[model samples]
Target: MRTDYPYDLAISDLREFLARRVTHSNVLSEFQEELDSSLKRKTVPMRFIFEKFIKYTNEHKQFVPYTKDEEDMIDDLFHFWG
Candidate 1:
């Protein structure tokens, strides 16, 4: 498969290849299940995602849920003032 080709089919083929690499075997079926599950729910906020990541990285240290933009503003103010 020439991945550089243009078409909806090309994108589909690329997705199939990535799924094969990520899931190992049963690529199509496993991703179909994941896609179905994702379609069934709303996406979580980045703050929530960061909190979970911080917990994992910090070995259960509690995370304050601050969004990225808010954190950036705080950093900017502190950088200029302190």
Candidate 2:
């Protein structure tokens, strides 16, 4: 009998996927810190600050490359219970 495993998957593809997930997680964690600081200071609204930060950081290719929809989803998740 043959197993239905993904034997054709390349190691490089797995590495790339892991790297992307890690980078995305790191960016979101960093954003959480910024959000907390901003909230404590009462400087601006959380959503506004998050949107501005995402817009500015996303311009550079070196940073996390979240699409507009992904950013919106992340924003919603972060604020959902907070």
Candidate 3:
């Protein structure tokens, strides 16, 4: 069936795929691009997105590994929102 919420389904599916592809620093930027124009969200925080990515990568092995150092850097960069 054709639905008006393809972007929503795509985002949910992409989130799973992104768990295996995106690097640490690109998380926020990717999330921004994912929702930009295609979808609308209510002010999702950097920390929220970061934590979700972190949880995803933790559960699976990614093609792009997110090292501990990069994680710390992301924490510092977004700590205000964290």
Q: What is the lDDT of every predicted structure here? A: 0.39, 0.44, 0.51
Clashing residue pairs in all predictions, respectively, total: 0, 0, 0
How should the candidates be ordered by lDDT, best one leading? 3, 2, 1
For residues 1-82, write the lDDT of model 2, one tens digit per residue: 1122121222222233334543556655655565556546643243554464556456644475666755554444344412
**Poorest stretch of ten by lDDT in candidate 3:** 1-10
Error of 1 at 65 (Å): 36
| Candidate with more favorable, higher TM-score: 1 or 3 | 3
Candidate 1: tens digits of C-alpha lDDT, residues 1-82: 1223233332343344335334334534645454444335522123432343344536635344656654563343233322
lDDT of 3 by residue, 1-82 (tens): 1223244554553454455456665664666575453447623245556577667577655537556755554444354334
Candidate 2 clashes between residue pairs 3 or more apart in a chain or in different chains:
none
Instruction: Please list the residue runs of candidate 2 whose C-alpha ends up more than 4 Å from where it truly belongs after superposition.
Output: 1-23, 45-82
TM-score of every model versus the real structure: 0.23, 0.30, 0.34
Error of 3 at 48 (Å): 2.0
Clashes of 2: 0
